[model samples]
Structures are given as C-alpha cells and as structure tokens.
Target: MIWNENIECASRDSMSQLQTERLIRTVKRVYHDVPYYRKKMQEVGLVPEDIRTLDDLVKLPFTTKTDLRDNYPFGTFAVPMSEIVRIHASSGTTGRPTVVGYTRNDIAMWAENVTRSLCMAGVTKNDLVQVAYGYGLFTGGLGLHYGTENLGASVIPISGGNTQKQIQLLQDFGSTVICCTPSYVLHIAEVLEEMKIDASSLKLRVGIFGAEPWSENMRRDIEKKLKIKAIDIYGLSEVMGPGVSCECTHQAGMHINEDHFIPEIINPETLLPVEPGEVGELVFSTITKEGIPLLRYRTRDLTRLIYDKCECGRTLVRMEKCKGRSDDMLIIRGVNVFPSQIESVLLEMSETEPHYLIFVEREGNLDTVKVQVEVQEQFFSDEIKELQNLTKKIKYKLESTLGISVTVQLVEPKTIERSAGKAKRVIDNRKI
Candidate 1:
C-alpha cells in the first residue's frame, strides 16, 4: 500500500539523517537567496552553520504568516523568478493572500507527496478519481489533480460546485475515488438523498477529504451516508497544499511526509517544543521544496505527534486529527470554547443533523452564544413539548461539554446553507 517504500518506511535514524541534510541545504539556500530570511537569521545572531543536526532546528527563527505577507508577492521565494514554474495563494480574507511559488522540481515533489497520500488512502491507477476541490489560485484542486494523474489514475478534473452535475458525473464516470473537503462531500450526499439516488448504485469506495477540520462523528456520518471509507487528509496552502500528510487505510492518525516536510509539535503559548504525543501547535519545515522553502513555519493547528511505527507498516510519524486552531479558539463569557467541541456534541445526537452554525453576539454587558442546528425531518414534530424537550436536550449537552451556557435553536432540515467548499462554522459578531 506504501507508494515509496524506501522513504515512507525508512528507519528513524535514516530519516532523521536525511532530514538533517535537507534542512541544512534549505537553510543555506534561504539564507543566501532571500534577504528577509537572511535578515531574520542575522537578527537572531545565527547563520546556516548554526543548524547542523535536526536538534539545531530550534535555534532558527520561526516563519509566520506575517513574514510571508511582509515579503508580498515574491520576496519569500528562494529561487530566481525565471526558475519558478508555478504560483498559488491563500484566500487572504484577513489581509493580503500568502503567496506560494513552485519551481518545476517543487511541483514534481508536490505531486509525489500527494501521490503517496492517494496511495495511502487506497487509491490506485485503475480507480477513476473525481477532484471536486476548487481549482486555480486555491491549491486543493490542482494539487489533487496532478497527484491523481501522477499516480496513473484517470482524473475527471471536475473541480468544485455544480452539485447536480457533480452527482451526474459521479454516477456516469464511475468514479471510485473522490477528493474534496469533508463538508462538501456531505453536501453532495445530501443532494444524492434529495434526488432519491441509491448510494449502492454508485462506484465510490474511498473518499479523501481535507482543507478544514472535521469531527470523528462527522466522519462516521459521512461514511454511513455515502457508504465509502472516509479518510482524513491534512495540509495547508502555505505548506505545499494537501500532500503534507494523509491517513492510510488503518484510519489511525494521519502520516506526515517526513522525507519532504519535517513535522514538529510545540506549545503555542510558550513557543517551545512539547513532549511527544502531547497536544500542541503543529509546525512544518519544508526541506525539499525548491521555490519557497520554509523553516519552522507555524501552522497554528492543534494536534499531537505519534512517532511510533504504524500498524500499516509505515515508519513515518503520524499526527492526531487537529482539535482546533490556536487563533480560532472562541472565548465566550470569559470561557474558551472551540467549534469542534460543539460539533462533536451535535454529531453524537441522532436527532440533529451535522450542519450547524455558532453565532456569538454581545447582549448588553454579557456575551451570548447561540447555536442553530438542523433537525432531522423525521424528528421534526408539531408538538411544542416535544420541540422544547429537544432544545433542552441539545442545550444541556452543549453546556455540559463546552462548560458554557448556550442557546440551542432546532431548525428544520436544510435550514442552514451548505457549502461546496469549507463550511462556515462560526460567526462572531461581538466587537471585541
């Protein structure tokens, strides 16, 4: 099942040695080519020589999204513009989009990483893959696109949106493997239900989902509805897209592609490395990237690392599914809560649908959190007492889990808008 046995199953000592060598070369390249990196290194009173072994990585300055923005379009690029073959960017909702460039070699490496990920997810050359992630500036679509092609699989290249057409293509093309965001896949499943389409008639067997955090409950719901193996894939546009890590058929933690990208877990508050198997901020250092090699880039995702060999026989380190993001944490009435916690609670309830939204608003001197969730059609009834009981049950569970009182409103099915991309899970209107 491993795509590259030599690298994927390499011993810890050998992998560490390879990472150290690549890390040294990356440091040298960035220190000499990128003035911003050189200045950052000089500010820390260090040079490329300071990073000899993997242990020395702690001495290097950490890269952040702000650093990428300050550099703008091309300042972060290590190679010359002539050598750069491709460019991709983030949505830039907060500010300027974080731009990423890829040289020809970088593109090939990216494809290899994703290809390895696809193989780990049980995809093969014989399976027809449908890529529903948005293409172009967004890295998800094309990242999976080229990887599927590189794996020698037939690719539909359907991109995102057009739900009806997507369903038709899924049935007609006989796509055995689907790649897209988890939420989008759920939306597609909803559409199939609306059309009264039998999931048994479809050829889908495996689904590779990523680009957003999803709960384990949601994964089970997806698998049950679609009748496909729901696999969690992790990646960020800033760190070479969706190929950074993926789950094998084992369905344990996602395996990090340590050969190309070095994975690290550090306490976000202290900015120090956490003990192995402890939850902390996930960081990555792109060692083999040619165009935009990054050193110790903070991903802001919260997860733990498992260095033990996997049951699937791969020796690569695995990262537990992300709990939430450090910046995405919401403090309601002086109590910190994550949307995933609420999601976990809702998904556990059979009466409620997976789609829900959290609305945080300031009411006078107090902040109120209101959760609007969809109730299954079969559960919807005209009895006021029954509705009140359902609401109370949801509110009690959420308060017990989140440790904060919340207003639970049970709406009808399909009340909340579904997305073909990352779902908007939270809307905070408090002007803090």
Candidate 2:
C-alpha cells in the first residue's frame, strides 16, 4: 500500500541526491529572502554557496522554538504575508505560540505528504476517515482533514472532544479510519466500554495516532481494545504538522519523507550527530516548504533511525517510536525519566488502566516523583492489604524501570481527567 512509489521507494543514493539539490535551493532562497536567516548564516561565517550537498547540513545554524518565538509572528517567514495562505500555531503553553505559515504550494505539499501517509496506512478512497484531532491554531485537525480529503477519502471534519458525538458518527457514518492523539483514542475506548458499546459493532479498521509519544505497550493496548491497526504518525506544527512521516502497514517504524523534509539524529547535549541507529534529539529541515522553510530545526523529540528497507518495500528512513522529548524529560534526583517509561511499565502490568499522571516535587534539595495511576475497575478494591500489595508491586516495578524511588498511588477507574489532544502526563511543581 505504498503511495507515490517513485519517491517513497526511491533508493537511498537517489534520495540523498534529491535532498542535496532541494537543500541547496532552499538555503539560497532563505538567505536572500529572510533577514534573520541571512544574519544567522553570517554569524556562522557561511553562505548558501557553502552548502553544496546534503552532507554539508551540519554547517548550518540550528533553529529552535526560542528562535521562532524571538522572531515571533512572521519573523522567520521567508515570504511576505501576502503570499502566506494559512497560519497555524502551537498552544504556546510555555510562552508565545510558535507560529507557522504556509504558501499555497506548502499546503499542497502538506496535503500530498498526508495523502501518502494515509495510503501507507492502507487507507484508500473507498474508506471513510474520521479526523478527530483539534483544529484552528493547533495543526492536528485541519492537517488530517486536508490529507484525508486529498486522498479522495470521505472525511468527517469532526474536531476534538464531543466523545458522544464522535461515537455516534462512528456508527452512523460507518467510518472505517480514525485519526487522533493516542491518548484520546484510549479515552474514546474507555467511553465505549462505559457505554457498553461493543467495538465489534464499529467499522474501524485502522487508527492513525500522533501528537504524543506512546509506547509499544500502549500501541498494543490500543490495538487490542479498539481492534484496529494502530499506525504512528509523526510531525510538529513547526515542521509542517502530522504528515511529515508515517508508519506503513509493517508498523516497524515511521518512514520519514526525506524528499520534502530531511531527518537527522543528534546528541542533545553535544549538539553533534549521533552514531547510526542511536537514540537522540530529532532534527528536521523542510527543503520544499515555501512560506516558512526551516534549516536544522531542533524538534526535541528523542528517537532513533532505521535505514533498512521496510517489509512493505519502502526505502525511506524510519524513526522508532519517540521515547520522549529532551525538554519534557524530568530530572528527578539527577536521573532522567520519561513518562513513556512509566507508561510502559503500567501497561505491561495489566492491572492498571492506561491513564496516569506523573508529579514531580522538590523536597528540600532532593526531588521526589509521584505516580498516580488508575487501577482497573476489576482490580480496584477496598481491602487495605490487597491494595497495599498492588501499590508495592507497581512501585517496585517503576523503581526498577525508572531507577528512582517513586510514590505510587492507585486511584479508582476514570479518576484522571481525559483530553482530546495531547495528554498532560507530567505535573512538575518544581517549575512553579
């Protein structure tokens, strides 16, 4: 089910050559059109002419969220606002939202990538797709919507939330494909259970999930509960949203669209490329983007690369499931912990639900981490000894996995608030 066979299955050498040409042209365009990029290049003592090939990518300056924020609004845009056809932004929870713009060509490219992603997931024009990601400033909803439409598949522009409505549409519309955050899909599964709706009654066969890092265990849970092939889609609003890369039917790893966006792995601390197949920060450069072409943008996501040809026969580079973000990492007692680690532990145990929260607090110079997870309704009990044993078992497993003592609190099912977008997995009070 590979789409755009020429590009998706292109040889590594050919793809590299294509990337080199696009990278060179993108650099020249940005240098002449963007003052900020010109200044950054000048600071690095390099010009567009220096970037002769894809291998010279390391010579360019790295862009970060701060750089986009400092540039603000349209600062990083290579073209005038008149040419910008659309605008999208992050939630800006930490500060001003990192804004992104798109020219008509950029939107078409985005649509094409997403359409290819849908095909990679085995979606076709015959399947009805329901897109439940959030829209507007957030890129998930509209991104999936356009791609589904471009694929000639019937798309339900149903944005996030309205779980009851989502379920109703799933039934009435007979939607065969769903796209949303992994956590939200879990939430939908939970509601289905509560409502006593048999998943077998639905027509869903494939789910495309992203916007948050989910573990293999979580993926298994999603597949088992929903009875759908869960495919991971990777993207950031800053880097052209959800269709940047996607997993084929093989589901081994997400294939990066190297022709439009070049992918790299670098040691987050040393700021150098890591050894092949090593886990590190994920960086991207959008060579085909027009309104906002970025050079070596730091995505902060932690993942490794897989270059082997996929079973589905695509030769594009694949990125393993994201471990977590370097910045989203919690440094508790000098040991790094990612929520996905804790999530893998809980889901593997089979006694707890997928919903959980991590709370980090500083007690006198020492940092303490607490995990509040929901126990399955069948496992929840008032017996003090039984509850204590369950808590101890979970605590021990987590301590072994995270290498840090954590206070584990088991709560009743459905205790944690659910989200239709990115789940709030961590609550770091130390920042406050």
Query: Model 1: per-residue lDDT, tens digit, 15-77?
Result: 999999999999999899889899999999998999999999989889987788788888999
lDDT of every model, 2 decimals: 0.87, 0.87
- Candidate 1, residue 13: the lDDT equals 96
Stretches of candidate 2 off by over 4 Å are 329-432
What TM-score does prediction 1 earn? 0.78
Question: Cα RMSDs of all predictions?
Answer: 12.2, 12.0
Error of model 2, residue 420, in angstroms:
37
State, as a TM-score between 0 and 1, how close model 2 is to the true structure. Answer: 0.78
Highest lDDT among the candidates is held by which one?
2
lDDT of 1 at 123: 95
Could you tell me how far off, in angstroms, the CA of residue 100 lies in candidate 1 after the best superposition? 0.5
Worst 10 residues of 2 by lDDT: 328-337
Which whole-number lDDT from 0 to 100 does residue 363 have in model 2?
58
